[model samples]
Target: MVTRKGEQTKALILEKASKLFNSQGYRASSISDIMHETGLRKGGIYNHFENKEEIMLSAFSFSIDTMSHFFSEAMAGKQGCMERLLSIISVFEGIAERELFPGGCPIMNAAIEADDADLLLQEKVREAMDGLLGMVRNLVQEGIKKGEVKQGVDPEFVATVFISTLEGALALSKLYKNQEYMKRAVHHLRSFLAQNCA
Candidate 1:
């Protein structure tokens, strides 16, 4: 069993590593980078993790969890599909405005970098993406059942468009060192949701 201090150390390591991996390409980030970021010696880090791959994946999961926490906070007490969806978009906007991840959305960052990365890493990205999509799809279905969304709207398509547009806009916003790109996407999304889902 892990001791309390051990658990704390592991969490610290994951937190630092997640930021490092997101800022630097995961594959490009070496064990030395993680050690440097966490201020932990090789033995210190290796004590909690079996290998670099373990650390990498764990860190990736940590990043996703961070984003999920924000989503949960934003959507709390919200009712109906449009409100919930707008809350989600607001969360994404906050990501850019607050500079939540200096390297952009970790899932998109890792997935884009995973083209030449390990197959396991690629598969992990797919699983993470699928989970995000599933959440949005479920929200759309619930909205449909509640008679908020237009009849026969496809959950799969809504999830894809919502995520894809927001992610692309985020990247552009980051690249240009401006928030207007994200604001524009959010505006367009709000209009689309109001028309189609209201």
Candidate 2:
């Protein structure tokens, strides 16, 4: 069983670390910075995670879990695989518009910041991204099975486009600090889906 205080501490650390990692990038953020953000000492921080890499891994996990939960919740009452796919896409679009992450999508940020530099981080990013795209691909495949999506549609290709479009929107939004670009990208993406999807 987990103690309430211990769980609280862990949650607090993860929250601060996620935000700091998002804003500062993994290369720039330090354990000390995390400590400062959480108002915890070195010992307190280290007590939960062994090193910065460990914290990074945990933060990545936290982000994936959070996003997955959001998607699941958003699609709870919705029916049809196409609608489900749109709901998933819409949730991410909402996140982009809200600038949910100070750094952008955690997986995307990790891919750009650490994928080439750190193989471990790269693997983590790859796994997380693959998992998300896999969800989309499965949804699309289900739609095809139900005769909802276009016949002969390549689920993987569709998933890739969806992922790419969202990531591109995020990059643009962060660059311009404007949701308009993201909104437009999302609009175009949705239009493409509506036009192409059967």
Candidate 3:
């Protein structure tokens, strides 16, 4: 029973900390902030995590899992590469609309926050992004293997372009607090996929 309660407390800390970190830049969010967010004093938080860095790592992992869950749900019935990729775009659009992960993309936020200053966090961000890009690349490859996408289409190029476009548009949308940028991105990506991937 004590073990279960401890686990519960740890989860609570992670949930609140992740939201706090995402909303406020991770580097700017202090231990005091996390303590306040979790409604736990220093000891209470330290009981679960050794330090701010540890909490940041765990919270970042939690964010990645949360994002992945949304993607999996969006792609549930999607079969074709274009279909799956569009679903992915819809997820990004949903982000711009604040339907998910309210503070913005975790990977993007973390990358900007930790760039050049925090080696560990930077590595984590890179790994997360690689996974995201790989997912797109694999989908494109599958499309070609099934003859749904044009022969000789470069999955590598497609993945890079696909993610950069969506992330860039998402950043713009977030900056303007308008969903139009994401909507425009989705529009162009759909057409790009249909024409180029065809």
Judged by whole-model lDDT over C-alpha atoms, candidate 3 comes out at 0.90
Model 3 ranges with Cα > 4 A deviation: none
Ranking by lDDT: 3, 1, 2
Question: lDDT scores for all predictions?
Answer: 0.89, 0.84, 0.90
Off by over 4 Å in 1: none
Error of 2 at 166 (Å): 1.1
Answer with 1 or 2, whichever has the higher TM-score.
Answer: 1
Candidate 2 worst ten-residue window by lDDT: 94-103
Could you tell me the TM-score of candidate 3? 0.96
Q: Which candidate tops TM-score? A: 3
Looking at model 2, the pairs that clash are none
Q: Write the per-residue lDDT of candidate 3 for residues 142-177, one digit (tens) a residue.
A: 999988899988999999998999999989988988
Q: Which wins on TM-score, candidate 2 or candidate 3?
A: 3
lDDT of 2 by residue, 1-198 (tens): 668997899999998888888778888998889989999999988877888899998987888787788888889998887688778777777777654556678888888887566888889889999998999899889888888888888999989988898888888888988888778877887787787667
TM-score to true structure, per model: 0.94, 0.92, 0.96
